[model samples]
Target: MSHPTADRARQLLDLHTQPEILVLPNVWDVVSAQVVAATPGVHALATASHSIASTFGYPDGERIPLDLHLDMVRRIVQAVSLPVSMDMESGYGHPGDTARRAIEIGVVGGNLEDGMRPLGEAVAAVQAVMDAGRAAGVDFVLNARTDAALRADPQAPRSSVIEEVITRGRAFLDAGAPVVFVPGLVARDEIQEVSDAFGPRKLTLISVPGASLPARELQALGVSRLSTGPFTQRVALTALQDAAAEIVAGGTLPAGTRPLN
Candidate 1:
């Protein structure tokens, strides 16, 4: 049976191929989602799992229960008119079950990372997601993350790290993930090398402090998608802390606060 949201899946995938890089602000809750959705002409919305877990008093990884995570994603979907993608970290078991849960929640696509798993294991997980999608007649977008660039030993040779990421990226594409996401490879040459190596295959880069390339420049370097993981959430939390401190000192409430339905 085809998933009810199969059409949305294709639409989300098309956005990535467009000339403009698909930039997802990566919200964690209904309020953050509403703020982005309210902006005129926003393309889509994506949830940052790390932010969601932290808000729920848990750390990253699958620290939050599957049901709870799905519930939050569902709420985000209900709150936004744009397509929403869940950051399904290592997935909540196998890739098929993860795909099932994500598609069931009305999300069009998701980010599936390798985490600490072996390369082959990660590739298998991506294939499992693809298999599930086929059985269900769905075409979900799998943004595969290879952590070798981010998690490998710093003393390792740059050539080896780049090769590992490239190799895993090739495997991920073979496994049916349309986009390869390699966070922490913010250097310009490294990003270019991956882009050149993959040729037509799309690359997703994380937007972080001290990124050697800007968003548009990354686009020029062949990056198809750019997302800020949990940086925005951290900024918000810091702002909230400052506001609370003022409130405790008898200062009036901040002016831009709005109520949500």
Candidate 2:
């Protein structure tokens, strides 16, 4: 019989290739995971590191302990049947060790970014994740993220940043990264440029959160994945704030506001 875990990994991978764009509203905790899992046509679940950290009152950049993060991921994984991917910012520990823990909880994929570490070190970590996946017999998809174009260092020129992204993206893909994630490149033309550079490699776009470029625009640009990171959570928070203020002011609650018993 086929390995169930392997099948889950394959299922997650298959979603990335379907005709309709795979839209992942990255979730933070178990409730959010369950909510997304229960939604119609959600192919897979992903955790946004920023949102997860905030959910626990911790800052991003691995301020939360690796074990704590893993436990939360475990709960979310157990709460739903969809395959889940983690935003493992810089692995926190070695990527191989992190991958082992994540696999233990049935995660089939993860986003491993450089987190502004030395280029060589980041590349090595990516290799470690790939190796761990191989040893575990899980086709774990590692979405290798390069930050060159993420913040656009004031010191570096735009051309240089794009150049670095392509360079790192190429090296990572060559080293076995399944997806090249460039989160901060939101412009339609830039998206196209990056896609053109990567060719067959999958580009995970965290660009234009909540309809910046629209789904069709991204699909036309050859984006394999669109991660609506933490932004979705932020939108919910905004709505809640509005509803609370309305009630405090003795006004009618918003249409979707619910009271907690």
Candidate 3:
């Protein structure tokens, strides 16, 4: 039972030369994972906690049980040939045990957010988890996420944002994170500043909206990875809602609207 896909994912992390950003599209289920894998140059696939939780009729705040989350990861790995990365929200347990379990289940890498935890403690937790995975003979890419922008009010000062990201990122890197992800970033200057601060020592993953800069532009800014988060899931859900509303209002189904297979 050699897991070539899992091994390939670990190798992909080593294949980075420059920043050479890999834009990982987040998938909610097996079908979405398969479809994204069929696309050109998609090195790896990531799962969105928001998408997974919503699909199960639960909100995104860890309402879904650990058993359910592991099941989702197992099914996605079985469904796709590409390397799979999971959104293991807070690693699901104590750092060491959770990382060991995730590696055993075949998630090549994961995104762990430092949500409200002090920077030092979050870094230690991430390090412990990463060490556990490495000790299990699996190379794990712990993409530490700093949710400062997402958690803070829109009017929060720029100084606050910079300080928070820097402080948290330093801690996560010290703990052995291969990359740091900053979500909700929009401006080119901000992206550049963050990347510059991190430099070649670590990868900086950015989540950009479709309405924002194009993919080439993001890569030009030295983003090591770009993700869309749950945007695709949101789009799909919105379209379904629109069609359902039409049907409920005695209107015919839209011409291009086909039932999901």
Candidate 4:
């Protein structure tokens, strides 16, 4: 019999190849995971480090202990049948070890951030993650990320930033990441340029609310995946805040609120 997680990993990998853009509304916990997995069209799930951290009362950037973070991931994996990927923020200072632990808990894939680390170091991190997947007998979907667009110097020319993104993105792909995530590159022309540089269906993108293009437009640009990084949780929290405010001001909870858990 096939390893269950291996099967899930393969299924997750296959989603990237289909003509439809793989849309992942990143979740923070079991309830969110269950809700997204229960959605009609969602094929897989991914965790948002920022949201997960917030849910646990910590700030982002891996402020939560590695053990604590992996514990949450383990619960999420147990809570859903769909393949789940983690946002391994900068690998928590040890890319390979963190991935190995995540895999041991049934996580089939993850996003590894570069954070504008040295090119050689970033490439090695990608290789380390894929290596861990191999040792675990799973084809991990490594969505290698370069924060070039986010970390770019304010005074730097836009072309230079694009150059930095392409440079790191190419290196990440060459090192075995299935897709390169350019998180802050939202413009049509720039998206087209990066997609062209990376060839069809090799680039993955993050959708910032009010900033990203529509899924159809991203698909037309030849992008392979669109991840809603932390926005899903943010939207949920926004609704919660509004509801709380209403209750404090003599208003009742909205009758339309759906119980997801």
For candidate 4, what is the lDDT?
0.93
Two-way TM-score contest, 2 vs 3, winner: 2
Could you report the Cα RMSD, in angstroms, for every candidate shown?
2.2, 2.0, 2.6, 0.9
Off by over 4 Å in 1: 1-4, 247-261
TM-score of 3: 0.88
RMSD of 2: 2.0
lDDT scores in order: 0.85, 0.84, 0.76, 0.93
**Location of the lowest summed lDDT over 10 successive residues in candidate 3:** 201-210
User: Which number leads on TM-score?
Assistant: 4
Report the CA-based lDDT of candidate 3 relative to the real structure.
0.76
**lDDT of model 1 at position 69:** 89
Q: Write the per-residue lDDT of candidate 2 for residues 103-214, one digit (tens) a residue.
A: 8789999999886577788889999998888888888888899887876787887778888888888888888887889978887777788889887437888745454788
User: How much RMSD separates candidate 3 from the native structure?
Assistant: 2.6
Residue-wise C-alpha lDDT for candidate 4, range 109-174, written one tens digit per residue = 999999888899999999999999999999999999999998888899999999999999999889
Q: If both were scored by lDDT, which would come out higher, candidate 1 or candidate 4?
A: 4
RMSD of 1: 2.2
Rank by lDDT, descending?
Answer: 4, 1, 2, 3
Q: Report the lDDT tens digits of candidate 3 across residue range 20-99.
A: 66777799888888888888988788888889988898888678887897788789888877777788878665767776
TM-score of each: 0.92, 0.94, 0.88, 0.98
